[model samples]
Target: MRDSIRLRTRARLAYTACRRTRCSRGSLRELSAVAVLITALSSACENPLAPELCGAVADQVVPAGGAVSVRVCFNDENGDGVSLASRTSDGTVATVTVRGRVVTVTGVRGGTATVTVTARDPGGLSATVSFGVIVPGIVRLTDRHGLMPAWSPDGTRIAFLGRVPETGDTGDGSIFVMNADGSGVKRLTKSISAVAPPAWSPDGTRIVFTTRDFEIYVVNADGSGEANLTNNADWDVYPAWSPDGTRIAFVSDRDDDIEIYVMNADGSGTTNLSNSHGRDDWPAWSPDGSRITFTSRRGDDIDIYVMNADGSGVTNLTNNPALDLWPAWSPDGGRIAFRSGIPFSADIQVINADGSGATNVTNNPEYVYGSVPRWSPDGTRIAFTSADRNNTEIHVVNADGSGEATLTSTAGTVFGDHAWSPDGRTIAFSSNHSSSGFHVYVVDVSFFGKAAKRATR
Candidate 1:
């Protein structure tokens, strides 16, 4: 009986090999009769030279600069020794290394790559499994108090308010410029009391900022031409430059009550856009220079309002009972993102440009407050600051209220006033994670993949 089974097993193996090699259909039909009779016999005496691989062969997503390990089980049917090797499809996207049965992959950049692991036996039988590797994570840029960073129009440099450590006076802050990677940090304005974040001109040559004395100032990118755009005495602040570089919209109480005003690029042609009885501040210009958005208190609640560039057709974009402030226009001008809920306990909310489709993005129960929801230039993600029970950290969420990620993880530190680089590759923000005072920081936004939760100090 054993001899008969052995013969049947050999015949079945030969038939399978013939079919795999696309033999004639007549031979296949002839083998079909024997295939059923020898199937169990072949299974009992399978070839040992053939190699088999076990474990997941699905693609993996990894953050840039992060590593992931995949363990595969390899075995030979004949009980012979098996070896494994690993390789990457693109070395620039990721690197792969083999150690026994484990394959380690390291991401080198922010793109898709494939990894192939092969198991081979001494009998010349080999099996290969291919999977994808993706790398995404955050890169810390600065270590100092770099508050309210604004990217240049060219997306190469960043301008922010740097707190001069202990200038021996009440006002120690100055307007500073640095490369987008947090290098070449240069103080652009010396001996001036800069109180607000600087806004870059459309041409990238000038920066407009506000002072503690309620005045608007503009300085050259190299700190050469420092001029006060608004020398008024009625607290002019929150200057926003139009997309065309033709006008700047700011808030001032020069009209007895705080209201939205627009001035030319050189601080001329000042006109009140929202001359409401309520206080309106925090003016932000639309990307097309056709509209301006600001926060107002026209009713019992603080809401977001929008108006034409020429200070007409004022419309309330967010008229909820909850205070909606810090209105930021998306790059496409289709939606507006802002902060809602009570003070110090707010969430990031987005609304349509026409005052519709309001959604709460960061619905964290422990959230104390969130601030400055800046949209990426691509208009896909929104970066902001949120504080929980522990500390205030930088966070980012998708435009449709998904993929909430915490970017910073310094206990007890406050990170706020974030600005996205024009390419949407990095986020520049203000944080005191390194010391007692807030400093500027730039973190790669693309690295918010699976490895983003790893604390970046």
Candidate 2:
């Protein structure tokens, strides 16, 4: 009934208007009468057009501490004055300022921000164009295939290995020290071969790195007081300092088989901890300095083993048939994260410190063999590389294989070991994003995409 009444009312109004206009011969005659009525009803004091806004704005990507500029405008035919301004919805990611028709956005930190450019006219008409300004969370810090990034204990400086001057692209790299912000990169030693992850002393005053000549060398943070810890080395690599800074555990093949060796901080009193018959490498000390975990191949399948600090009480941790390598101890010394499975299809798994309760954290089996598991300083999350197709990405997940998040998605990109900052805010690693040269890179963990999440407790 309501529908029929509304239809009848509309028909009656149309017929009345058509008759009142006195020219209802055709549909065009009635339409002309209605046009006249519209002109009469419109406000005579207003202009016909509001404002024509500029076309869509493009998304802007800027590095942290960098700035970019974009232009926007409005077209108003009313002869009214036009004014423009820009604002950012998230100042922590980016901030914007407007000058005339231009809008300049500066990246404050990693993440994404929404920038809105608004234009207004004197007739109370406004037009706006909104776009995103993104600051990449994973930023390339160094160039030319920089590898082996290690943060100083103080977190104000970073020690890494990268191509040095005069070496060009032909040489491997050398030890380097730089400010935490990627500035003040100074070469600390000569060129090296068979590079390993450098270790910084607990006191933040010394750095231990491997050289090309199969020797372990220690130098002051300022590139002085260089000393060969293993003068007659037979492939000594993976130098890691103990928790108390009294001894350094490293991998050496001096004996018939590769074994883990510990030496005093001053390059004296070297002792072999792993007297295994098979390969042994990647030594990591527990937090309390009472135990060391390493990759060993004493049995048919490679596994992880933990031994007392004084080279006693060796126990197998991962009893898997596949190869398990790159053992990294959690900060609290309660768990260890390592890479498991065979090549081309490996997963990162975490096992309890006492060699029980093993859980696979990265179930994806596409990661390359180099995805070493690194635990955050808080020991709540594990960061590793995940490869899909041919591209590898950095990803983080909880210890129990939950809350997985991708930190990087660069195509055809390979990565190195991950080093967590002491404060657990950023992760340092190596990437070849520049195409020509691999360099050191840092990724902000707390901020992933367009927003920042509170740290996982």
Q: Candidate 1, 306: how far from true, in Å?
A: 1.1
* TM-score for candidate 2, residues paired by index: 0.69
The residue ranges of model 1 lying beyond 4 angstroms of the native Cα positions read 1-144, 165-171, 447-457
**Stretches of model 2 off by over 4 angstroms after superposition:** 1-110, 113-136, 143-145, 167-172, 191-194, 448-457
Tens-place lDDT per residue, model 2, 393-453, is 6777888888666665455565567788998888887766566767788888754333422
Pull out the clashing pairs in model 2.
145-437, 145-438, 146-438, 193-212
CA lDDT of 300 in candidate 1? 88
RMSD of each: 9.8, 10.7
| TM-scores for every candidate against the unseen true structure | 0.68, 0.69
Per-residue accuracy of model 1 over 1-457 as CA lDDT, tens digit each: 6775777778878888998999999989878867765664455355434677655565565545556787878766566688988788899978999998888887776676778788888767788777766554444555555677788989999888876655565336688888877789888877688888888999999999988798999999999989888887788988888888888888899989999888898888889889889999888888888888889997688999888888889998777899888989998999999999988678889999999999988787688656778898888889887777767777778898886655555554555477787878777766666655666666666544434221110
